[model samples]
Target: MKRPKFFYLIAGFFILAIFLAGCAGQKGNEQGKSAGHPNVLKANWQDVLSQAKGQTVNIYLYGGSESTNNYIDNWVAPRLKKQFGVQLNRVPVNDTKDIINKLVSEKQAGKKDGSIDVMWINGENFLMSKKNNLLWDSFSPKLPNVKKYVNQNSPAIKNDFGEPTQGVEAPWSQAQFVFTYDSNKVKHPPKSAEALKQWVKQHPGKFTYPAPPDFTGSAFIRNMLYETTGGYKQYLKPLDKQTGLDNIVKALWNYLNAIEPYLWRKGETYPESASKLDQLYASGAVWLTMGYDPAHAANEVKDGRFPKSTRTFVLKDGTLSNTSYLSIPFNSPHKAAAMVAINFMLSPKAQIAKSDPENWGALMAIDPNKLSSKGQKQLNAIDRGKATLPSKVLANHRVPEIPAGYVDYLEKGWMEHVAKH
Candidate 1:
């Protein structure tokens, strides 16, 4: 029996709709599941060591510091090669975004293996990569050296901004926001927002921060928000969502508005990154700079990047503290090797070496007391700049970090307000 014309047309239309829907669903599924596929080359540490014996693992690391690069080449790579027979290839990047961009490009090209073996990061970048399904999951627990040297309960073992690392990313170095000023230039530094404003007006063009999206820039903004909002003392917990946005954030905006024009470059432009801010200080363009790596300035001084008279401090308030972590890309060709690298990074010997002034001077992930006697001696022997901002100063001055979500929101808002203007 032949169907009526309308019935035939409706049947054809329905069939086409179903087929299109199925295709759309398949695409969505593929996109969702792309970050996970057993076909991806992952191996246990021993297996990876065997496979990579004399092979190279491209380690994408932030390369702003010459000492850090040297550490990788002279120290980390040599040790890995000597012990594990793995050749480490350092792919230095100025920003973690570079790696993210590369991973994205690789994904777009459908290149599955032989990509970046390991990357160093933490905070928003880690979350962004994880949320986008850009990184491997739960490989931290499987490293050959996971059981050694690290205390899983420490803040360093966790992700930046209080995010759960979930063993997807291995913990690397600890860092804190440190404020540094030229002792010869600024005899008495301002200790608070009100004081800082007066000081900035007195010393225009002598202070500036790295632009936002850089960790230090965002950290400055976070500290300002914390102080103005009076919620800094409680920053570790999730923010109060029940509070009305306007009511809670009103003071913060007001504080920023008041201080915006007074910032170096007259609120117009900011240094591109924290390292550039250090350069600005070295050039006498800015008297002050901040770094997430607390010992950064000291390292700079030791290397002649800054005057030896330059000293680091926190505000009368404590400096912002956070950890930088190592994460594995979901498509990492050698997951086990990446894991081994991260684990090695967390070892006491590595941490101590990383903290030396000639090195990166990043704080150790493990507690100082838990370190071996030699490790403690090494940690103590390092000057780490004088801790002039005493425990009381830090305790009383400690401000809260904004919710992680607010960081991105504020960046967009700050751009729209300041950048567009």
Candidate 2:
């Protein structure tokens, strides 16, 4: 049946509107493709290098250590700028949470371009960022240095505190738990967690840990848990509220409670952070301190903060060891430049320079076995310092980290069962 002209005109208008809307949606999808997804750079290596030229990559990292800051600012930054024509802006953050919070806020606001290009992170922070979809993905495998030198199968490389890294972050350096003591004061240091308790009892007010939630303190607690329990094997899987709190962490609380009265300040107070605990050790107020970095004692001694006789040791059973990583934010504005910077960091030259005790004193994430003979020789030439424990000793006594979920539960339990009690 033939309709009126007005009806036919309205029908034609509707058809055109529908077609336009479809075209607009297609365009939007195409735009999204061009913008690039996380870790999926649409460009090849040369293209990426070209795109990164003249770009500035802002790196956010914990600013607790002057030496680390100096290494990046003086050595890394200069090399990046000279070689890649990229500007390196090191943004010092008191804590990594500040960076995460900012990223979350930016995501909530739908900000497409973010300020943070790269971040130095690991452990629970890495887990949190990955879980929240705040990090880019799977880019480390593409980096030439990582592909050639990194031991991809190593647990230290594959996991961050038992949370699978999944290539979301590129390993920056390795760390292991170590106790530092003034050799003049401690003729013989505790060789195990059990011995540590007796030592604490015998020399009251001479030892203490930084409060939990501080990175080093949390590690110290986990190390204790491993020693108290049979091993860290049971904590290999993901944890839940019930099992994590009730079964897994119960023994840790008991141990802490038993040793609490012997802690510095008679268990009434504790150092707020690792640096504070270091201060106590430096001032001769405490005989022993602890940290995740094996070379930290050496670095402190070099800085004249720690006594020249300061020495580091790991427990007989083992000490926790893990790799820290540098990750890009999901909304990073300069993905290529960030990748360039991270790739440079993984290079043999950078790793060797970073491992020097005079510089950062960080363990290289790159495997020496994978490097050329010259590179191996260079790594061997770096002095690990008198205070630093030998790499072979560290490797022999290395332990794996527990899952990230268990961390907060343990920290809270410490407060409830040991701190408050």
Candidate 3:
């Protein structure tokens, strides 16, 4: 019953082919799983919605702005509840770092089910969370809306302050740095860093920025650094902490030092936060107030927090622009609900609603070209209030943010060289 050598060889070949085919199938499954875990990556969109029903997702965000809080509470919350059967619980944190700290603590304690489901995060905070393994693993790519509407190749989508997002965070909104001033007070506003410095010298006690570590203040410093260092080209790569501080940041310190004596309060102290800086501008203590939110001045004008003549402007050399993102904590108790909510937020309907000046006034993160005709019309219909600069203006003057590591170096250098000096 022994087979001939040719028959034996043929049988061996068939067995080897089957084994290799089995191995390939297994490898393909592994690759599929690696793309996104099955728990968050459902077989269909309906499956995600079905599992998300009746779940309460807690979203932790910076609740500094009453308008932002109201928008979430009044608009987004109700929509999620009605459409997805998910209760959106808005957990207001004074700073995103508070949430990151809590997540770190939970991770250290080996907690499987953490309280925070979704968080508003970007830049240094996002880098920290991702580095510390505090964020969920690549769930953003699983969302249908993101896959369809988001331009994944765009730098704003791919990178957060020069650090790769790796699909862990979902972009929520766009912001650009802008300075606000009363048109009556500053007849000819400074249009570049050199002009701003000269303006400060000419109008001493009239201009100041928030101390570093505050997002807006940090941005102002970065802009100055870019201006002095011949435009942000040299600082785009991953930072070599001490080398960058010594070689690149020395110029920044020198620039700040030269301007220190002419700064408000003779550079004796800086406003603690952007809100405090805004207060100074409102009370006529300072002529210049700046923020990452370009629409903020418009909102302030409407609310009568700022004068009717208050207007927003960017530097001629362009100002930093970035997209803020939402991410899930690593140990979220309700992953499905969080995914459903984030997907909904990325929808054209939600983006249009958020673009309204009365609501949040954040720029749409979704590309208009990808949107349907109805969606495009709704987005276009939003009246970008009188105080808000035109979209084309912002776009023309937009600049990229330097890497996140540079932030800490700049802040520390400011404290040592400028604040202490």
Candidate 4:
């Protein structure tokens, strides 16, 4: 009887150890999701949507463009509210670079619950944010639209200014460099950097680009760097990796300086902002203006801001094309809602609405070939207006952007080299 009692006691001890082991394993799995996101990554789409409902996401972005502002306020916000039960509150800043600086400050202050849920970001801002680890985990891949629509193999999708996105940002819209001219004033547009220099010399005080540190102006310099230097392919590597970069930039400064005397105000002063430049063009103070938006000239015409003769043209060699993205902050309290919002923005239906010039006139970020037959038909149906170039023409001349470091270097160099002299 004593031996049988001892055997039962041993069995009870063994079972107790097994139960404790299972509990420890369960705790470890819970701790694995330590980002304080409440398991957004592991949850299914339905669960994410359930968590996103009634969440108000704060979207920070550049608020200068009237169409961009109207699109967010009137179109995107209402649809997001009705469809997902998520509220999108857009916080506009004069510059998006400030948003990056704010995130850096928030991180240093050890603020665990940041207010920025999603931000419209790209280029040097994205680079700085990634360096500081201010972005949330690899959340882009988890977005259903990105998985279905975006081209997974494209180099542009994988990298931002040569920095790996690592699934931290979702591409929303694409814009390319195009010169806007009033056809009544100018019969033929220049097709290359050299041709533009001659056009300025021949038609003095009729053309001018906004000063640098201005986003459009800075892009203008980058495109010139490619045209003046041997094409852009050589500069695709990191800026530091480029040999004789100091010497290569001199040609750009020279080209710009050569055209300085013929510029509006004789190069003594430049329109302070792209908007100011656009105003000059509107008032007929200048006959031409430029921007990253290919549809910009067309939209201006439709809005009665520009003449009906307004037309857009790209360089013969190549034109700069950049994609802007939506990113989630590291400490965002509503990651689920941000993801849901970004995913919706990437969808075919939303992109189609955004593509209409009356809406936003932005080019859809997703590939057309990847879309369903119905979706592709809708995208193809967008008029894009007479001022906007055909898709095939823009596509043929598109060039990938140089790394951000080069952009920063060139923007500063313009101030020292071209602006001062």
> Largest lDDT belongs to which candidate?
4
Q: If both were scored by TM-score, which would come out higher, candidate 3 or candidate 4?
A: 4
lDDT tens readout by residue for model 2, 52-165: 778899999999988799899999999999999999999999998999999999999988788899999988889889888999768888888888989999888998888888
How high is the CA lDDT of each candidate model?
0.70, 0.88, 0.88, 0.89
lDDT of 1: 0.70
Query: What is the per-residue lDDT of model 4 for residues 1-421, given as tens digits with 9 covering 90 to 100?
Result: 3568878899999999999999998876554333334678899999889888888999999999888988999999999999999999999999998999899999999987788999999899999999899998888989899999999678887888777888999999888999999999999999898899999999999989989989999988899989998899888899888888889889999999999999999999998899999999999999999999888888899999999999989999989998889999998878889999999999888888888888889888888898899988888888999999988899899999988888889988999999888
- Residue range with the least summed lDDT across 10 consecutive positions in model 4: 28-37
TM value for model 1: 0.81
Descending-TM-score candidate ranking? 4, 2, 3, 1
**Candidate 3 residue 61 C-alpha distance from true site, Å:** 0.6
Question: Can you give the TM-score per candidate against the true fold?
Answer: 0.81, 0.91, 0.89, 0.91
Task: Please report how far candidate 3 places residue 17 from its true position, in Å.
Answer: 38
Which of 1 and 3 is ahead in TM-score?
3
TM-score of model 3 vs. true structure: 0.89
* Candidate 3 structure quality by residue, lDDT tens digits, 68-105: 88789999999999999999999999998999999999
What's model 1's lDDT at 112? Answer: 71
- List CA RMSD, all candidates: 8.7, 3.9, 7.9, 5.2
Per-residue error at 382 for model 3, in Å? 1.6
